[model samples]
Target chain A: MEEILQLVVFGIVIGSIIGLGSMGLTLSYGITKFANFAHGDIMSLAMYIAYFIVVDLGLMGPTVFSLSFGWGMFLAIAVTIILLAIFSIAIDKLIYKKLRRDKSNIVTMAIASLGVGIIIRAVVTMFWGPFARNFVPGIHEAVPITGNILIKPDQIFIIALTIVVTIVMYYLLYHTKLGKAMRATADNPDLAAVSGININNILAYTWAITGALTAVAGIMLGIQAQVYINLGFNLLLPMFAAVILGGIGNPWGALIGGFVVAISSEVSTAWIATGYKPAVPFVILIIMLIVRPRGIFGSNI
Target chain B: MDFLIIENSYLLLTATGVMNWFVGFLTTFAIFAIMALALNIQWGFTGIFNFGVVSFFMVGAYTSALFTIGPPGEYENYIMGFELPILFGWFAAMITSGIVALLIGLPTLRLQRDFLAIATIGIAAILRAVALSTEGFVNRARGMNGIPRILGDVVSGPDYKWVLLAITLTTLVIVYLLVEKITASPWGRVLRSIRENEETTKSVGKDTVNYRMQAFVLGAMIMGLGGAIWAHRMTSIDPEAFNDLFGTFLIWTMVMVGGNGSNKGAVMGAFLCCTFWFGFPLIQESLPDILGNKVFQLREISIGVLIILFLLYKPNGVIPEKPKISRHL
Candidate 1:
């Protein structure tokens, strides 16, 4: 019973991370029409930014509301998201825009995204020297929820944060005018353009929101697992599995898909070896592909 | 007179050593050239974006190594412990990887364009994950070592490398001719047509899936052969050795830099990349520890930057893919 609860708690945290990280990928795929391989690296970049702020800037000494990090990490996260959004736009303008102008195929853009990822990975290694770094120095003790159930304060913080973010995101998607415009644009770009929607504005918003969401995922992952050069790249597969499992281009589907992948991966460890946990989602994905090519809630685009 | 004589002998020895390094460099180039050719058949000829080259290559290496290497003895325990013929091992590698490709390609081919890349990357990771964790398969983490060399016993030392070079180059020439022949055939035209526009080709009655599957399997077979050659050269095998940068990304860059649609361009790009990929290790030995490692990593960055720059600046590559004459024209 204890192990199951522990795994479930861990699963939720991981699921939220996947959900947040993959929100950007699915959004970009919907609006931009290609998977940004560099998004994973961008997440890594965000996590590193947070780490640098916490460690290098001496935000390491304080505690806030039972969490190890303080205001500096929060400030760093804000800065990271803004900078990452701007960076995404710059990359689009510099690299992808040319391909778009030339009417290049999706494969070209995808490969270009890979190139972008490689460049970032190289930059990270060059700067950080290819070693793993931790955000907080030591391990935090878990508090008992009951006789059998114990969870960390950070874990609770993560769950609450995820829920708050999800509510805000849901409200933004359903209630806000800009959100409707974004949704309309994603549904039918040609029609949206015909309807006089500012496609460029939507694209920019998409980039910014995607960057922000990707950042959150990266930071959360860093908190759970140590931040390394390959942090984002390693998650790339599972994130993709989630996106595809939910059906590409559907954000809500991606949210659900994230939980599916996270839970399955965590649960399967009882039978499958721990090292092969990553493979569990992959097997699920392949089976999903065979049974339902478009995914559960995904409409074939 | 004694000092002068010593200097002359040192210069002579250095010359011989550098010549040996050059020979080894050429051999590395040949193996990469085979991979470039295989990738060309897939991406260049058929436009099937395959990012799982490393997985197939690893499979090939292990399969062939398993076929030929003697029993694991006391230290290592592995499946199919036998000492088969060299040619048989190489053949077995191709067949094994080819079948692996076919099984994976069946359901995935019908998906959207980049999904293939995503799916293949997943598949490759799963493969690596399994290889790492499974105790029964290839002895898990320690990896199979001390595999018998292909022609290590018969030809030896400096002169034997020349024999190895001759053999490697001969294979390259044969693969080049075979690929050229296939690309020149009408069937090749059909494949190119699909690349130009899959839906249109399908409308015109070509079995696009079959052709793609063919390209994928054939290319995988070639990659396997490349892996087999690599294992033999190293006299060992490891899951880590067949990494993306070394196996998939590097070869893709080679094809991209060389000219994806052009066979000769693929071969040309392989030689150029091999110069950087292999040449650096030799130079690294001469440099200070930290500096050498940094320079080594810079190569990866350069490849990444190169892909972006090329895509932005030179999409057709160093040797531009010649526009095929359409039958309608």
Candidate 2:
């Protein structure tokens, strides 16, 4: 029971990060109507950005908010979000816009995105030299909840942040006129155009918000674990699995799917070897694809 | 007089260098040509999107290496090495790779194009992870190295590479002719029809899934043959050698650039792109100090830019495959 609880807690922590990442992917896919393979790389890039701001900037020591530690985390998160948003917009203009203009096939676009991903990975590798870095200092401290069951502060923070972000995203996606317009565009771009929703503007906003969410998820992940160049590359498969399993272009389903993937994978480590953890999501993805191609919560818009 | 002689000699020397470079380019072109033709049958002909051709290539290389090197009977670090004749080992490697492809294709062939692509990538990733795992088969990350060279002892060392190159080129030519004939036949026409509209082909009583599987398996076999030839030429094998995304991406790019659905275009694309890949880096390295490093970076950037440009501007590739005209009537 203790081990199970411990595993569940740990699973939830990572699951929250997966949820956040999947939200960004789901939003982008909903708006763009194409699966962005480079989404995971964006997460990695944002994490690296936050790492630079917090650790390399030497902003850890000072206390700002009357709390114990300084507001370095907030600062890092803010800067990362801004950078990621700008990066996404730039990517839209430089790479994706051209493909869109040409009316490229889905496969061509996917391949182009892969090329972009390779470039991003290579540039990151060139700069960072394939090493892992951490943002927070003394992050290993664990609070003992019970016998053989301990919870880390970072994990608690991740869960809390995930809930807060999900609530905010739900409100923004449902309550606002802009959110309505976004949904309109996603439902039927042609009809949305007829209804006076600017397709390009909605897409731009979607990219910006998605980019910010991706950055926040990256920072949270970095805080929990560590940041590396291949961090996003490693997560790409599982994240895709989560997205597909939940239903493509459905943010709510993505959140649930993330937790499901995370818990299942972690639990499977007990029965199967740890090395096969990545395979768990892929197997799930295959099964889901065969059994329920549309996914659990997916509905045609 | 000395300056004049040196200048005159420089032209001759450059001519010889160009000739040698062409020879090297042709050798590589031949190997990739076979693989590209295979891809044409799958993607261009049957519309089966396989994003994991490299895995089959890796299998082919490893299989041939293990067989030629004999059983690592005493060497507990390495697994699966049975001493066998060269021809038999190469044939076995081809068959094994085909079987692996069939295994992967069986479940995945029913998927849509996008799902198929994702599944193929997953398989590639799994194969790579298996290769890298320490406890798994093939000795973890250390990789099998130092396989025996086929035909090197029979022919002189310097002459052997050229001889093997000739053999590869011949095989490529044979494969190309065979593919051209096949694609022009009634069966090939059905594949093209399937590519254009699978539903229409199915309506016409064609089993599209079975046809796709056939194309995929045939492509895998050709890729395996290429891998066998490459292993013999290099006489070394490693998991890392095949792990890079370039292995699959480069082949796809070659196919796209040459002209999908055209064997001639596939051959041309493989030869030209590979030559540029090998030669451009050398030229970059040879440039004067300030420009040399910049050129290398530019080369990397150009690859990404070119892929985008090609997709946008020349979706059909440089030399589009011409529709076959029947002369029988």
Candidate 3:
């Protein structure tokens, strides 16, 4: 029971991050109608942005509740969102828009996005080199949540933030004009166009939201774990698994799917060697594809 | 004047040697080009979007490595040798990868293209994980080394390379001939029809699934051959050698740039893109410190950029597929 509890806590922390990242990915896939292979790189890029702020700016002054962050990390999150948003939109405007206009096939778009991913990964490696860095140096003691079940403050912070973000996102999605327009655009682009929803603007907004969500997820993962160039790429399959499990373009499903994937992987370490942890989500993804390619919450698309 | 002549002659010899280094010997370009040919069959001839070309390549490499190595008789702590014949190794490579591809394809072939692509990637990831963790056949992370060369170590330098090249060219010709024959047949026509309009092809009573499976497996089989050839040349094997960026994506870019559906285009794309890929490091060595150190990463970025540009502007590739001619009187 203690082991299960610890695993659940750990799973939720990472799962929420995967959920957040998958949401961003699914949104872009929904609106753009193509998988953005660069989504993982975007997460990694966001982590770098935050890393630069905290480390380079020397803003590691005040600790935030003794968690694995400082005032500088908080500030970095805001800046990361802004910068990543612009970067995401620019990517869309440059690569995706050009490809979409050319009436390119889905595979071509996918391969192009993969190319984008490669470019971002290579560029990040060039800048950061291939080393892992953490938001804070020293490891803090794990606080006990229950009998023999201990959790990190940062993990707690991650869960809380995920809840808050989920609520805020739900409200924004349900009660906003922009959200409705976006949903309309995702559902039927032709219909949405006919209904006077500017598809391009909606797409750009989707990219922006995606950018912001990916930044938060990236930064949170960095805080909870370590920030590495391949963080996003490594997480790509899990995120895809989450997105597919939730149903493509289904935001609500993505949140649930993320937990499912994370838990499966975390629990898998018990049965299999830890070295094989990365393969868990992939196995899940294969099963998901065979069982429900349309996904649990997704409509036939 | 004598000094100038000698200098000019030296430069000429050096240039020839450099050229010889790239093309004259057992360049992996032959192997990559053959893999590209395989991809052309799968992606170009039939649109099976596989991003896990390296999985089969790995399968080919390791199978050949294990088969050709000396036999592990009594000692558990052996050099992990198998002592199989070279031809047996090569055949095993193709067959093993083909079987793996068939298994992967059986479930995935019916799914959407994206699902298939994702599944393939997943399979590749799993294979990599297995290679990293399991030591039974793959020898784990340390990797198996000193596997005997296919041709015994009697030949040296260019002669050795030429032998490898001869073997490669022969294999390439065989693969090319087979693919050409397959593509020209009614079965090949059916594959194109399936690629163009699956629904229409289905309506015409063609089993699109079988054709896809055949193409996927055949492509993988050739990839296995490529891997086997590569392993024999390197005389060793390791999992990391099959990293996807170069191992898989490069092949996709090659197929795309060479004209996806055309066999000749596959070879053209393979040569052009691979030359650029291997050529960059040499050029980078002469560059300033700031740039030279990061040339490898830069090369990846450039390849990435090249993929996007080619997809965007030259989707048809350099050598576009020829338009069909009418047989009407």
Please name the candidate that would achieve the greatest TM-score relative to the true structure: 3
Question: Tens digits of per-residue lDDT for model 3 on A114-224?
Answer: 899899889888888999987778877898877788888888888888898888778777789998888888888999999999888988888898999999999888888
How many angstroms is residue A46 displaced in model 3 relative to the true structure, after the best TM-score fit?
1.1
Cα lDDT computed for each candidate against the true fold:
0.82, 0.77, 0.83
Flag clash pairs in model 2: B70-B81, B71-B81
For model 2, the stretches where C-alpha displacement exceeds 4 angstroms are A55-70, A136-139, B1-26, B73-76, B134-136, B284-299, B324-329
Q: In model 3, how large is the Cα lDDT of residue B260?
A: 74
Give the runs in model 3 whose Cα sits over 4 Å from its true position.
B1-20, B24-26, B72-80, B153-158
DockQ each: 0.69, 0.41, 0.78
> How do the residues B113-178 of candidate 2 rate in per-residue lDDT, one tens digit apiece?
777777777777778777776463776677676676667668875566577778888889889989
In model 3, residue pairs whose N, Cα or C atoms come closer than 3 Å (at least 3 residues apart or on different chains), thus clashing, are: B44-B260, B69-B82, B69-B83, B70-B81, B70-B82
TM per prediction: 0.94, 0.90, 0.95
Better of 2 and 3 by lDDT: 3
Per-chain TM-score of chain A in candidate 2 equals 0.94
Candidate 2 CAPRI level:
acceptable
Per residue, candidate 2 scores C-alpha lDDT tens digits across A99-131 of 788776567777777667667766665555577
lDDT per residue for candidate 3 within B1-329, as digits (tens), equals 00111223243358766655655333567888899999988888889999899999899988888888876534222334668888899999999999999999988998888777777877887898888787464677766676667676666765676777777888888888888898888888888888888999999888889989998999999999998988887776677777878679999999999997888899889888877787666665468999877978888998999988898889999888786555782
Residue-by-residue lDDT tens digits, candidate 1, B1-329: 01111223233358776676677778778988999999998999899989888988899999999999888778777898679988899999999999999998998877666878888877887788778888777877788888777687897866887888888888899999999899889988887887888999999898899999998999999999998888887777778667776778889989988997799999999987777666554454457877666765676777788778787788888987888786799
Preferred candidate (TM-score higher): 2 or 3: 3
| Tens-digit lDDT string for candidate 1 (A230-252) | 87988787788788788877788
